[model samples]
Target: MPEDNHSTVTEFILTGFPGLHPEYQGLVSAVLFLVYVLTLTGNVTIVFLFATNRSLHKPMYYIILNLSICDILFSTTTLPKIISKYWFQSETISFTACFVQMYFVHYLGTVNSFILLLMAFDRYVAICHPLRYPIVLKKSTIQILSITAWVIAKTGPLMLVIRAYPLPYCASNIINHCYCDHIGITVLACTDRAPYGFPALVLAMFILLGSLAFIMFSYCSIIIAVLKIANVQGRIKTLSTCSTQLIIISLYYLPRCFVYLASNVGITFSPDLRIVIIMLYSLFPPMINPIIYCLRAKDMRESLWKQFNRRIFTQKAQVPSVSN
Candidate 1:
């Protein structure tokens, strides 16, 4: 075999939301900063609550805990550099670091899809097979599933990076997307991009649509089982629990499918517009997931209130004052 050619480009500049006006740069950075802060705060709070609260030590929240950690990691991997780009004008990422970022961006996303599938399975067992839910989805079982998701999510991303990273990048080093990804980087390669691009597209469709189909089937069964409950209150209560997951699932899957389908079917948007849509689906769910749990799930609300009251009481006790 001949020696592989080396890339000419040593660093890549991330052009976040390409064609973004100079006037709006600060505004976009501020908004993204707030989103990053909220994503971390919300997901971190969920993890804290799960760790400190014993009542949430169940299969459903265990899945949620996995998702929260994934969200935190995904946000951290993609946000800071873009925020720096728009705010502080620091945009260059080394060739090696760019691919490293690309790997996590794809890896964590695949992990999220798998975790959502696990969420659907948990709900399915709880509602469709209530008697066996505990037996089937114990903590140990959930831990194994979560571990498997994180491990397996690495395959597609690692393959993409391995195939793409070695290509001669003798072309432009400006990435038009907010973050480094398989498509954004591979398109710059000084070689035919079809081999790298096609596999990624197929893998993405498989992960998103395949998981989505199973989730839909699980919910359909859950709905059928829910309707059979003779008591109105029971049916309503069961649906209420499932509704939160539905909201999350819809937020995660629908926009993604639309974007991916639209891109392939000839419906086109400007690059900036497409990037904006991607960011919407990517960032919005993590920001609101914990809020959904608190507002929609009774147990989470009660636990949050308990934690809040405890903090207030501690603050009050710590205040030093002279008696009037």
Candidate 2:
């Protein structure tokens, strides 16, 4: 296709949610809107709690703050547009907007994976080398690592989008998901061979395989160190921390690995399965992260409750004073 021909394609259609009957658009919208709201509120609350609470200033909480931010970005990037598409049947996205959305989706997704890997490393250092944990995860070191992860996550995807979007999109440009996913967008390309396709594949491999491998290695070391503790109570306490980190890491990463690898392998999922996977990929992590951290970590749980009570009392106090 010529450049002029490609320029003629102004916007792309998103297939909305697959398997949702047109008649049920209202119901689907209601349900999805509720989910979107919950996701936003939950993740935002965690971010606020992490930021305002001075007690949450440690390395682990710092990473939790990053995770919360990533969750908010991830959900915002995909869900609201999906809800609109399903409800209003407005499926058009401009080429430029689609590229921007794709870049953020990939960036946030990769960042989420990298943050989880960092969390695993944090837990390992805490458990395996308790005395050195503070020194190792100092504010300066944490800042540098966080910046590095963001850079690593954004670099490849941004480059890929720059290369991919300029190619011809003369054929059908309807993406089949809520947002502009790489696989869905690739299916819409007029060219069979994508210039950015190989780079995307490499990035995915680095994130999915490389990150997961590093996390697993960290956990293995953590488990070994925990086992060697002579005191049973100490061993249990150490294992509990590692176990919570492991569970959240699995919930966040495994689905991602499955989806990315499946996409790479050309495995086609049904629309319902795709939606479910996307929900799991986007919503579940944000919803579960704070819950896991609060429940498993005593300090976080107390701080959260204290923060909640403090807000409630402050509001009550202000109301009485205003009324008086």
Candidate 3:
């Protein structure tokens, strides 16, 4: 607990993909950069599409917008630094910067999880309690809940960083990852046991298991309601709306739960495998989210096409006017 009882380790050396052949660095960098670009573009497009379309002003689209924003921040938190590390062979991150990175990464990730849960709740209410859905999920209520989620998600990491400040950083400050991950940072801690460990575990439970349970419960109820519907069209309509959400939730949660549980259980894998899983966790959801929403939500697709055709027609009309 003594603040001065530790070694003064200034920066952590990141051993990303250690012992990999140097020739593959460029290839890895290129692949990571491409994934980062796609993540950014896809999430930004979703945010823009939601923001511009007045028809998407409901609670569901609001949650989608928040989710997209969280995705943008989440990807930015880890991938850019990872790409830079591979591309430039720069692996050193200052303690302050590392903590900041970890904070935002957890914050955005937790917020994203909660937002998805809220989306599930929204869908559940719409499906199960159609009459009260609008009143239950008013604009003010959505805003309040969204802000609360962000605040709660951010609080744990921030406090953990503060608590861990007292722990000494000895000479061994090598982080075996491309970015500042919680486990990587903890591995570098010189103390016998990090003070942040328990809090981090609690946060992980809340973010992953708690959210997962909520989502599953909501979906279970949704499934039962859909089954009870007598009309085929009604059942199909409800099922279709929930299907994309189910797919996205599975993709986002399953890998995360696996990785997190594995790390906690001391089942250490190779750093390269770790990197691959982390990259998969970071990149895939963002890339797939827009695709799922656009493809599954008929209204979103129509809106996108409407906007696209409007632009094309505007350009064509402008050409004729210019010629005249």
Top-lDDT candidate index: 1
Q: TM-score of each candidate?
A: 0.97, 0.90, 0.92
Candidate 1 C-alpha lDDT tens digits along 1-89: 12256878999999998889999999999999999999999999999999899999888899989999999999999999999998789
Rank by lDDT, descending?
A: 1, 3, 2
Local accuracy by lDDT, each model: 0.93, 0.80, 0.81
Candidate 3 local distance difference test against the native = 0.81
What local lDDT does model 2 show for residue 38?
A: 75
Ranking by TM-score: 1, 3, 2
The sequence of per-residue lDDT tens digits that candidate 3 reaches over residues 157-239 is 78777776657777588887777867778766766564567677877787788889989899999989999999999999888
Q: Which stretches of candidate 2 lie over 4 Å from their true place?
A: 1-5, 260-268, 315-324
C-alpha RMSD by candidate, in order = 1.6, 2.8, 2.3
TM-score of 2: 0.90
Q: In model 2, what is the error at residue 87, expressed in angstroms?
A: 2.6
Model 2 lDDT tens row, 46-149: 77777788888888878877888888888888878878787666789888888889999889988988998898889888888889998999977887898889
Superposition error at 34 for model 3 (Å): 1.1
Supply candidate 1's per-residue lDDT for 315.
100
Clashing pairs in 1: none
